[model samples]
Target: MDLIVATSAPSLVLAAGERASIRFLEFFASAIRNPHTRRAYARAAGDFLAWCASAGVASITAVQPLHVAAWIELQTQTLSAPTVKLRLAAIRHLFDWLVTGQIVPHNPAASVRGPSHTAKKGKTPVLDASEARQLLDSIDVSTPIGLRDRALIALMVFSFARVGAALAMRVDDVYVQQRRLWVRLREKGGKAHAMPCHHTLEAYLHDYLDQTGLRDEPKGPLFRTITRGTGQLSKTPLPQANAYAMVRRRAVAAGIDTPIGNHTFRATGITTYLKNGGTLENAAVMANHASTRTTQFYDRRCDDISLDEVERILL
Candidate 1:
């Protein structure tokens, strides 16, 4: 609980020390349930408070809009707009919580506006349909690791699942429903999304489960780390960093020029679907996005159309 200790520092000190500290800790430990968001927000809040302390700010209550704006200005120089915006949000939310608890008189960050940013397309590098097929076909499925990798990649691409949700799956999440293979994903915000598997994904999953005998352990992790030397799957679930590394290695082996990440498959699938007459609303539903606007970021059909138009310039 470094975050707990952070609450007691001079940056957070107020008239009632214990009460203020308790509220600060509760903001992270209780108010935010998502581990990823909790960690990120905690880092942003802690860094901002530490900077304030170094600047000779006596207490959290003394923090003013000027202090917040100055800190944000400095952050803009080094961090991207999105990163700075998220940090600002983290500070705004913490102060709002403190104000509600009577730890502070008002939210200093309330009036501050972060750098404006609007994105119509996501930055995640996507594979063309041919490259995607090549990557999947290039895997040597003789080994259990190969089968697992192929299945995991296909699951993300087909279901439009986030890497976090795909790795969080359990053996039982893949189930037979009405004679078709279906996957249940526990997406962000504790959302449960169930999608019928694409036929290719169905085949890959069947081979992986049957060959590895993971079907017997229905409660075990769906995707697992490999034990070095043994080449056997470990009981622990595959970590996101490890999955990213694996994706990079597979892309290289398949001779893919685009530098792809775990999110690439999701974007690739969405783009392919939309190009093949799929609706944006339907893609949003499948991707579990709260809004179609977020889904539109993953729709990169315009990139292809733009390239086609660019080739029309004849000298």
Candidate 2:
């Protein structure tokens, strides 16, 4: 779907009035700045409104706390608790906006409660140090695609760049500072983070830039799509989906059976760093997390310990 500004008003919203339609659209268009968050919220709002309409609700204003609670209950039955909570939050926020604008009388979702959940560990899969090394070493960097893929993967492993930040990079984002290579990443909430390159990452990046001739075009995208037949880098920035596919394909080629995604590298990097004596505060800073509590989720050091203990109780 297009951005909220370009999209038509929902049927339930349209039934309210022109004012309600504009206010609803503005909630997504002006209230939310992040496109990804806006998309998720828009989807949640749409689903809820459609469900309300099917259940005999006449307009956006007619939605009540009971309707919100019922829908959240239904969501919990089909989706994970966190996802259901997020969806509820979207409706809650939308209603909050409508209330403030005087489009609605009150926030219906405000009083409704979502299901309870807690997470002590993140669900992202991580590669062990040896598996990570094997995957990197297995790549054949004789060609530009290989070189680009290697550099991208190394960027995530070494500097812990999120795939979005890594892909958003321009060639100039990689620069020499005091004779050491550093990468500048635009992280979430528009934060800019920079980290010095790990020695191996530095070598791989230099190889990619020098051999692929990307060094000459500093304004071009850092990670790019390959030309259809030539196997050469195109100017287009590689999308996150393509990057995910590349990693999956690479992992399979390297004989890694564990299911992995783009986020695997970030968690793997954090876990490996902590296992090698890196501080939690420093790891939090490196990952650009605002709190160490958030960083703790990625700390999977106990996983190995737990497995070893379990092995000792052999049948």
Candidate 3:
């Protein structure tokens, strides 16, 4: 039907005269089954709109295969191939909707190929038993904050938690029974996982809780920043950036050689378990990976490739 072009500073807003496309977009947003997917789609669409303005494609209908290709080429230099592919898919979706509404004659970039980006295949960092001990020992557990930091490191290592999941735990998420402690994790994609707290984690957590005077509050954050003056700890959950910063700061203090971040615990946990005869499937389940292949990527942490020669030398 009818097309109306509107201008914004960073975006060229193209509207359907009857408000059909806007309504369609709203409906699409509401109809999506998964909120995470819907949010990603919304971000991708927004980025595509900005790209369209930069490319001088005045309207969605005017966008061609070359325009799409040029965008992909531009993205290749700056973003990973997977990200570029996702951007293209987002643009394709908008054109598909335009075609359905008859706002465009055809989906011009319908057959455009996405950027070929492979997953990063790299060695994961690991802390041997000595290094893990050194890292724990680096924390001065005598002070209140130091005690909490020790408990945090022990909990992360034992549970193999993504730091975000660990930080999101509430006091009630931890339970003690029959001399064993357990931590309930709110994992990625809103999945809930229960992991047993090892003896070390239990001891540290016990000391931390007793020292901090955490009560039986089910909703307040489990991990909090300790105030200096009143000795008060905020109930607000720590952000992911803060989680990462904590890990990096501790790594520096411990004088770790390998590049370390919050993920180092996860990688080190998987590698350590595998070296100690734990199976790939078990690690995958422990890490909450959807596939065994994702766990396979962690095998690169082993320095020696010659270990695979076992079959050739077999009797």
Candidate 4:
């Protein structure tokens, strides 16, 4: 394919040749299907190439293992280990792609090692069950925006859905299945998962849909932006950044002290469910995780600070 991806190609990649530029672009465009991963990998590749240029590395082809190692070592000074690992992975994967395509003789990033990182539990701050309830109850359902926010939050909490999946829903994605509300989520890697709504989620979704008259527009976005002056739901879907800001605002208004984000409810729900006799295998299925190990990260059932244990200190 005679693709012209060089116009937007970085100087380091372009200096290598047309073949290298096309291969570099293809690494992100064709090899990586997930938009989030693609964007991250693109940023990593760009930043590394720019750094290489600044360091007087002539071209992408001239990149060496020492260059990648030094770059990653520099990254460790400011970035977290997991972040440095991901950046290294991006560089490693891109070079591997280039090597396979015959654009380069070797994968220079292959021999480099990233910073070590290991975690028994996730760092995402989870809300207590009462805090989740308080956040939900604090929303003013008198307005469409309020109802939308409540429902969106409830969906993530009760259904164990990622924020990306929750926001990607169409009104039609919520439908009656055997007299109960079911939500269809196209999760990561285009996995289609359908989940029965928790009774509370059902109520919230019903309120948001019926009160906002969103049920009438089955094909439109489920959660949407509010009109500039009208305070009514607009055609545009709510972005992830807006969702984060909204969650923070709602948490503060509800007097929740724990800092939380879009993923907090997901972890909170998983932890709550596990605490309430939910199994790891079942939780994994509900969360659309490929493995129980991944679901285990969200299981914060043991996260409670044991005041009893603390009081045992004689001092």
Candidate 5:
């Protein structure tokens, strides 16, 4: 079939347990879907299952709205609003699945509401060009591991890649043909996007690849750890948690007081480019957003919320 169905429209038919909860988890792992969404959903599901086990709930079918409500209430004590909302959404999805599978007559969680998340206020953490330079300069690229880390940071900033994408990257994914470097990313919705590498990042990548002797193993993981461990990057790309730790370590090493994490790079890239006159269309295309509004959400440049942009001057 050559037909292209819009995402808003339902294309796949749902029957009793045809898409089981366990199978849904597998769907996330195997499918080259939205890496961010996959990670979030995986974490949410894991938390729910852990809570169920601790609460003496024997099965997914045993979960009810009261249990979910209590979980949300407990989570509110420590979790941020966004985190609470995401968990609620995950639970809602689980019940929706149950209803669709005919395990439940109705979704108990369908009527439950999620926490209200506010837009980030007051100078969200982002690196300026100078700060980013200082951060990169703080790394001593003399050693092999240092060089690899430097390249990783450079590629992440230049590419505006989500930490998961960087961690998920494989050596074979980088194509250096036609006198330019391109990276293949499995983005949201299982869509593959090949973005042209900035020339600056390409140089760092070349040096890092050579130092790591990664040229021969094109199919191997892109990032690895110098110290080998069961959980360390023995062969797989570095774990997501390690990626966050790396950013934090680097920021502290640079003597930066600002809060730093994986997302700082992405937010910085979008805001910096937009402030420098990068159009919404260009940002949308580069960020691989399905809509410009999504791109705008990342470009938090602190513009005054003026009515002039929408108001009529003539009466």
Candidate 6:
């Protein structure tokens, strides 16, 4: 096979030689399938190698634990702990691959430790039940775009789906199972998760499909992009960035004060469910989480309780 080096990581090719460069490209092109993760890892690898070159590191094999540690320290000064940690992971994994391929004698980043980060609560901004309702009700469903946006947002909240999983859906993924509306999501790690839709979500989906005449196009994407100059849905799947922008615009239009994103609805739905006396285990199952601990991070009932306690400070 020919050596195919990505232009973004020119330093890797120049420092590591052709054999090592091919292994490096293979790690991203073949090993990492997820586009987002591949892009992040590529950036991390490229940045780290470029820094090494500027620091007078002679070659890729000459990099040591000290070099890795110093790079991480510099990263901590500019990036968040989680981001630094992720970059470290990317570096470590790349070296591990190189070592196994006999490009390097040992993994230099293997012994390096990333910055410590622990969080009981996630930073995703969540909305109250009333705010969520207001946002949904504010959309004018006179056009295909309106119906698409409303259905997409409702799918995330009602199904507790990640934005990626929600956008990955095909029209056939939303279908009748046992005479009730069910959604099938291809979640992280290629996990196939199916859930019966909430009544409100079912109604929104029905209206979206019926009005848009998308029910006949079962193989097409469930959420699609809108064509410019035409108020019609395109065959392309809705990009996550576009969905986020739409959510921000909708929130501002709804008079919501909280700065929310695509993830806000998922967190909001989980919090609302827990507030109404839902069990953690059940919530985990609904959210398709392998552990209740992961689901606990989305439970923002404490936010409401904290607000109530602050009211006790009477003058």
lDDT of 2 by residue, 1-315 (tens): 234524578889888877888889888889998888999999999999999999999999999999999999999888999999999999989999999999999999999988999999999999999999999998999999999989999999999899999999999999999999999999999999999999999999999999999989999999999999999999899999999999999999999998999999999999999999999999999999999999999899999999999999968
The most accurate candidate by TM-score is 6
The model with the greatest lDDT is: 2
Model 4 misplaced stretches (Cα beyond 4 Å): 1-7, 305-307
Q: Would you list the C-alpha lDDT of every candidate in the order shown?
A: 0.92, 0.94, 0.72, 0.93, 0.72, 0.91
Cα displacement (Å) at residue 248, model 5: 1.2
The runs of at least 3 residues in candidate 3 whose Cα sits more than 4 Å from the true structure, single-residue gaps closed, are 1-10, 14-47, 86-110, 119-124, 226-231, 304-315
lDDT of 6 by residue, 1-315 (tens): 443454534564557787887887888988898889999998998899889888988888889899999999999999999999999999999988888899999999999999999999899999989999999999999999999989989998999999999999999999998999999999888899999999999999999999999889999999999999999999999999999999999999999989999999889989999999999999999999999999999999898889999999999
- How do the candidates rank by TM-score, highest first? 6, 2, 4, 1, 3, 5
Cα shift from native, residue 310, model 5 (Å): 26
Comparing candidate 3 with candidate 6, which one achieves the higher lDDT? 6
lDDT for each residue of candidate 1 in 1-315, tens digit (9 for 90 to 100): 456656444355543366787788888889999888999998898899889888878788889999999999999999999999999999999999999999999999999999999887999999889999999999999998999999999999999999999999999999999999999999999999999999999999999999999999999999999999999998989999999999999999999989999999999999999999999999999999999999999999989889999999999
Q: Candidate 1: worst 10 consecutive residues by lDDT?
A: 7-16
Query: Residue 233 lDDT in model 4?
Result: 96
Tens-digit lDDT string for candidate 5 (62-181) = 667777788888889999988899878766775565576566667767777777776634244778778988998899877766777788887777887776677778898888778899
**Candidate 5, which segments miss by more than 4 Å at Cα?**
1-78, 118-124, 228-234, 303-315
Clashes of each: 0, 0, 0, 0, 1, 0
Model 4, 120-198: lDDT tens per residue?
7899999989999999999999999999999999999999999999999999999999999999999999999999999
Q: Candidate 3, clashing residue pairs?
A: none
Per-residue C-alpha lDDT of model 3 across residues 89-176, encoded as one tens digit per residue:
7677766776776777787669888867565443456677678888888987777667767877787778888787888888888887
Off by over 4 Å in 2: 1-7
Distance from true location, Cα of 219 in model 2, Å: 1.7
